[model samples]
Target: MPPSDAPAPTIRPAAPADLPVLGRLGALLVRVHHDFDPLRFIPATPETERLYAGFLGTQLQEPNVVMLVAERDGEVLGYTYAGVEGNDYMALRGPAGVLYDIVVDPAHRAQGTGRMLLEATLAELAARGAPRVVLSTAERNENAQRLFARAGFRRTMIEMTREVEGDAG
Candidate 1:
């Protein structure tokens, strides 16, 4: 957490002006996940920042989506992106709110910024009448796993991946 003298970060709906920092944070998320497992996650490329920002920019117009940012004195410290999704036959899941991304700048981690963003995201989802919310975390992200658990999420699935071409026998 920040020093008692420091102002607490405020959570608010993300705006077009926040795109630059949002893109940077989004790319950081991609890099961190790729670092956890190169084979399981997509690598971050030179265009990741711009591409991510542009993609999220489209979501800004989606009525069922929520994109939020945590800021302190004009500097964005983190963001969360989520959307309410319909039932999916492929995953055998019912309608739910899916958390797509939540990232905090490295310098601001472990300081309750992530928690604040998460809480705000949950509130937004609840306000939208989400029956339930689901999210996936990199298997190696123990910190995030702990956060989710503390927020009352329980395990429901484990995804497995295989490399078909390289495993011919």
Candidate 2:
């Protein structure tokens, strides 16, 4: 078992070998989101691991994407993903960065892993020339919101959804 006072994880760019653990963490992320709001997040399935592996592989090759992993004693503690993009027709702002996902293993929670990952990701996005960064967390995910706020993120928009009582179409 890892010691309670394990040293801080080393943050670095993810490699192909890290995909398996990342995929498992991705599945956990899916479960957390699905539990928090099933209507918004799809539940994880057996195929999710494979799909996430392929997706991460593609993201790794994208010039504007950043993927990082936090490892301690050769074990992955967490991972984060982000990307920079120019504002399209929908977005009024100029170039911006989007924090696509951040997931820390349950056992590593409260150990500063998530904060490290977030800071690293933000730095990478800034290095990529993004003027600002943005992300969305589930309404019930107060922990994540707090983390982002501590990292200097603020509420820029509110996403509200209402399910139609009956089919209008």
For candidate 2, write residues 1-169 as lDDT tens digits: 3677768899999999999898898888888989998877899999888788778988887899999999998999999999998985575677899898999999888888999999999999999999999888999999999999999899988888877788788
Q: Which residue pairs collide, candidate 1? A: none
lDDT of each: 0.92, 0.90
- How well is each residue in 40-89 modelled by candidate 1, as lDDT tens digits? 89999999999999999999989999999999999999999999889988
How does each model score on TM-score? 0.95, 0.93
What TM-score quantifies how close candidate 2 is to the native fold?
A: 0.93
* Number of residue pairs clashing in candidate 2, backbone atoms closer than 3 angstroms, sequence gap of 3 or more or interchain: 0
Residue 25 displacement (Å), model 2? 0.9
On the 0 to 100 scale, the lDDT of residue 126 in model 2 is 92
- Candidate 1: worst-modelled 10 consecutive residues by lDDT: 160-169
